[model samples]
Target: MTIDTALPVAAVMAAVPVRDAAVAKRFYERLLGATPDDSPMPGLRQWNLGDGVLQVMVDPERAGGGLATLMLDDLAAAAEGVRVRGVSLDIAQGEVVTAVARVVDPDGNAITLVQA
Candidate 1:
């Protein structure tokens, strides 16, 4: 007769729209350092981003680019890791332990990696 209020929160996926699924897939693969889960639908790709999946969907009419944010263990390290792969990154001035680095995908969507 007890409730499980102690259950931790989890993130499954963050669906993002792209102009071209292939391009998006390549972008994410390079950024995340792994291939994504292919879909039979032919217009979507899902990359496994740790506890969650990042879905790159094809939708030409999709708006609101550069609108996704992600929190990571070490933002600076994560950004540096990806930077070596030739990814253009932007970091905001703040505490090193609590900094944010924004990275843009080929589709122009921005995802922020924060240190916390």
Candidate 2:
């Protein structure tokens, strides 16, 4: 079969709702190695993590239990940066680009940062 299509999307945004905006902001800042650009919304923040944006919004009734795995070029560096920021590193699994490390945000959201 043959089909015609345009190129894929240029960017993506991962929106995550947190119970506390302040805590969420701090957690993401540490994970991304930088602060997120504050959104005009009263309780929303965003961080540009290269290929995609990490969005955090405040909602007292929010719940956490989602995972966002990032494909990083420099897994060691990224993991080190997170550690330097006081984030605990999990046990490493797999090998090469398949290695994975699961870390939790201040709000208790689980995120897997991998090299692939």
Candidate 3:
């Protein structure tokens, strides 16, 4: 399969903004079930997810405004795992998918887990 685009695309990464790196790190650590894989630069934490990466960046101006929906094979198990790790997310039925769990990070950035 090929995608048509005006500009060529190589790799993709996502950035989630937060007010404080320390606070954000803690929340993501639990939510993701591990510490960041890399901190390539100051004020930025990166996690390699499959072929992509997710970055938690310190940007107060954009904090609480970023959103991302992650694909999950088992939303129920994943939600329970995170909950046991001390992170809480609300699970609900979705119109386009089987189910979805929504969570707001320490800085309020929205993270949704979708089961398809």
Candidate 4:
């Protein structure tokens, strides 16, 4: 089938599956430094990160099997923030030109924070 050229498409939220919604909510709140902006429905929590939305949803089947990457202004500062929250970041590799850090959530979901 031919695609429509007049249609408009835009990127939306990224869903990260978690075992428990409540627990994940608290973890994300601490990481983002703010409470969830909205919870559209049960088992789903969302945070507005300026350009896009990050959704933490309860999904036992796929929990701990998700991955998300966040591009930040300062990787060091962000890593420090995570450490302050009692969360350790796994520094898989660091490039002098572009700093990057990896962290796993309570449910084992991988999150890569990169300095841009």
The residue-by-residue lDDT of candidate 4 on 1-116, one tens digit each, is 98888856465678899998888988888777789999999999989886888999999999999888887887777778878877776554465537777778899998778776
**Cα shift from native, residue 72, model 1 (Å):** 0.9
TM-scores for all candidates?
0.77, 0.81, 0.89, 0.83
Residue 86 miss distance in model 1 (angstroms): 1.1
Predicted candidate 2 versus true structure: per-residue lDDT over 1-116, tens digit per residue: 87769877899888777888888877888877787766868888887777887778886566485567777877787788889998877647676656788887766677888877
- Best lDDT among the predictions, by candidate number: 3
Error of 2 at 109 (Å): 1.4
lDDT of 3 by residue, 1-116 (tens): 98887777676788999999999998999999989999999999999876678899999999999997788899999999999999887889999999998898988889988998
Model 2 lDDT at residue 36? 72
User: Candidate 3, TM-score vs. the true structure?
Assistant: 0.89
lDDT (Cα) of model 3 = 0.91
For model 4 the TM-score comes to: 0.83
lDDT of 1: 0.74
- Candidate 2 least-lDDT 10 residues: 59-68
After TM-score superposition, the amount by which residue 36's alpha carbon in candidate 1 deviates from its true location, in angstroms, is 0.6
Cα-based lDDT at residue 63, candidate 4: 97
Model with the higher lDDT, candidate 2 or 3: 3
**Candidate 1 lDDT over residue span 84-108, tens digit each:** 8767677676675467877777777
